[model samples]
Target: MTRVRHWPTLAVLAVALALPHFTRGTQTEFAIEVMITGMFALSLNILIGRLGLISFGHGLFLGVGAYLAGFMLRHLSENLFLLLAAALIVGMLVSALVGAMVLRLGGVGFVMITIAFCQLFYVLVLSTQTWSGGINGIPSIPRPKLWRGTDLPAWLSLDSEFTFYYVALVGLVLLVYGLKRLDASPLGSVFSGIRQNAARMRALGYPVRRFQLIGFVMAGSLAAVAGALHASLFGLVDPSLLFWTTSGEVILMVILGGVGVLYGPLVGAALFLALFHYLGTLTDHWRLVLGIVFVVVVLYAPNGLVPLVTNALGRWRGAKPSARGAAVALPEDAT
Candidate 1:
C-alpha cells in the first residue's frame, strides 16, 4: 500500500528525468531553471511552512552560493563537487552568523531583519566591483566539468543541456526526499510544535530558538546549493540575485504552490515559470496578467493549489484526505 501510494511522486520524477529529451532549445533551459527554482522554493518552505518563519531575504544565501561558486570556478577548479561543497560550507557559516542575530526576533521584525541582511549583501556585492563585476555582473563562467583533471566520457559533462538537466533533476529529487524524511522525524514534530505554539514547545522544555536556528541554517545551505547550480547553469553571478525582490519571488512561488505540502514547491515553480515564460512572449504587460492570475488563485485556493488539488483527488478516489499522508497536511496546531 505504501508503495502504491507513492506512484504519483515516482511518476513525477520519471517525467522530470525525461523532460530534457522532449524539450528543445529554450524550453530545455527553462526546464532546468524550473528545477533549480523549485529546489530554492523547497528550501524556503522548510522555514515558512514548518517553522512559521517568513524570510524576506533568503536570496542573500542564494547569492552567496552563486558568487562563491563563480569565484571558485574562475580562480580555482571546475569540479562540481568542490564547488557545491564550498558553497554549502560558506552558506552554513553565513547562515549561522545571521541566524544567531535574526532568530531572536519574531513576526514582522524577523521579516524586516532578513530583508535588511539581503540588501546589505546586495550593496556589498555592488561595491566590490573588482570581484563581483559591479552593476554589469560576472559573465562567461565556464560550465562545471564532470571531474577536474580526469578524462571522462563526454556525455557526463555538465556542459551539455541534457546532462545538466538530469543532474539538476537528481538534485531536486534528493532534496525533496531528504526534506520529507526530516519532516516525518521527531525533530519535525518539534518544528511543528514550535510553529503551532512556541509557548507550549518552550513549556515542554524544547529549545525552540535553537531548533529555529537550525532550520534557518539548513534552509540557507540548501538555498546556497541551488544558487551554485544556478550560477553554473548561467555562468554568471550578479547583485540582483541577492536582492530582496529575488527573495520575494521565491516566497510567492512557495505560497502559490501550497505551503507545507511536500510537492508544493515543484508545482509552484512550474506554474510560476510557465506563466512568466509563456505570458511574457504574448504581451509586454505580462506582469499585470500574472498578478491578476495570482490574486485569483490566492482568493480561491487559500491554502494553496496543491492542497486543493489533492483534496479533490482524494474525494474522487473515495479516500479521506487524511489518508493521503502527512506530507499533504498542514502541521498540526497544538491544543
Candidate 2:
C-alpha cells in the first residue's frame, strides 16, 4: 500500500536514471545542473521547512565547500573521496561555529547575522587573492579520481560527464532518503515540536540550540558536497557563488518548490533552470521574468507551487490536497 502511494516518486526516479540515454551535450549538462541545484535548495530547506527558520547567508556554506574543494583539487589531489570528505567536514566545522553564535538569535536577527557572515566571507575572498583567487575566483578545477597515487581502476574515477551525472543523481537521492528517515526519527519530532513552539520544547527540557546546530551542520555539509560537485562540473569556482544573491536564489527555490516536501526542490529546480536557460537565450533580461513569477507566487500561492499543482491534480483524482509546506499540518514522514 505504501509502495502504491509513492508511484510518482518512483516514476521520477526512473526518468532521472534514464536521463542520459535521452539527452545529449547541453541538455545532459542542464540535467546535471538541475540535480545540483535541487540538492543546493534542499540544503536550505532543512532549516526553512523543518525549523521554520530562514537563513539569508546559507550560500556561505555552499561557497565554503566550493572554494575549499577547488583549492584541494588545485593544490592537493583529485581524489574524489578525499575532496568530498574534506568539503563536508569543513562545512560542518564552519556551520557549527556559525550556528553556535547565530542560532541564539531568533527571526530577523538570525537572518541578518547569517547575511553578515556570508558577506564577511565574500569580502574576505575578494581581498585574499592568493587563497581564493580573489574576484577572479578559482578556475579549471580537476574532476575527482579514486585516490591520489593509488593503483585503483580508472572505473572509479569521475572523469566522464556521464559518470558524474549518475553520481549527482545518487547524492541527491541519498540526501532525500536520509531526510525522510530523519523526519520519521525522534529528532524530527523534536524539530517539528520546535517549529510549532520552541518555548514549549524548551520548557520540556529539550536542548533546542543543539538540535538547531545539528540541522545546520547537516545542511551545511550537504551544501559543501553540492559545492564540490559544482567545482568538478564547471572546473571553476566564482566568488559570486558566495554572494547573498546566491542565497536568495536558493530561498526562492524553496519557496517555489513546496517548502516542506522532500522532493519539491527537484521540481522547482527543473522549472527554474528551464526558464533560466530558455529565457536567457531569448533575452538578457531573464531575471525580470523570474522576478515577476516570484511576485506572483508570493502574492497568490504563498503555500507554494507544489500544493497548488498537487491540489489541482488531487481534485481530479478525488484525493485530498497534499499538505506540503503548510504551516499547520503535522509533518508527515517526508514533508
Top-scoring candidate (TM-score): 1
Which segments of model 1 are wrong by more than 4 Å? 150-152, 323-335
Write one digit per residue (lDDT tens) for candidate 2, span 180-294.
9998999989888877777778889988888888888989989988988888888899999889999988888888877777766667777788889999999999999998998
Clashing pairs in 2: none
Best by lDDT: 1
Candidate 2, residue 147: lDDT: 56
Model 2 ranges off by over 4 Å: 147-155, 324-335
Count of clashing residue pairs in every prediction: 0, 0
In order, what lDDT does every prediction score? 0.86, 0.84
Worst 10 residues of 1 by lDDT: 326-335
Instruction: List model 1 lDDT by residue over 59-177, tens digit each.
Output: 99999999988888889989888888888899999999999999888877888999999999899888988989998778989888877566777766788888888889889889988
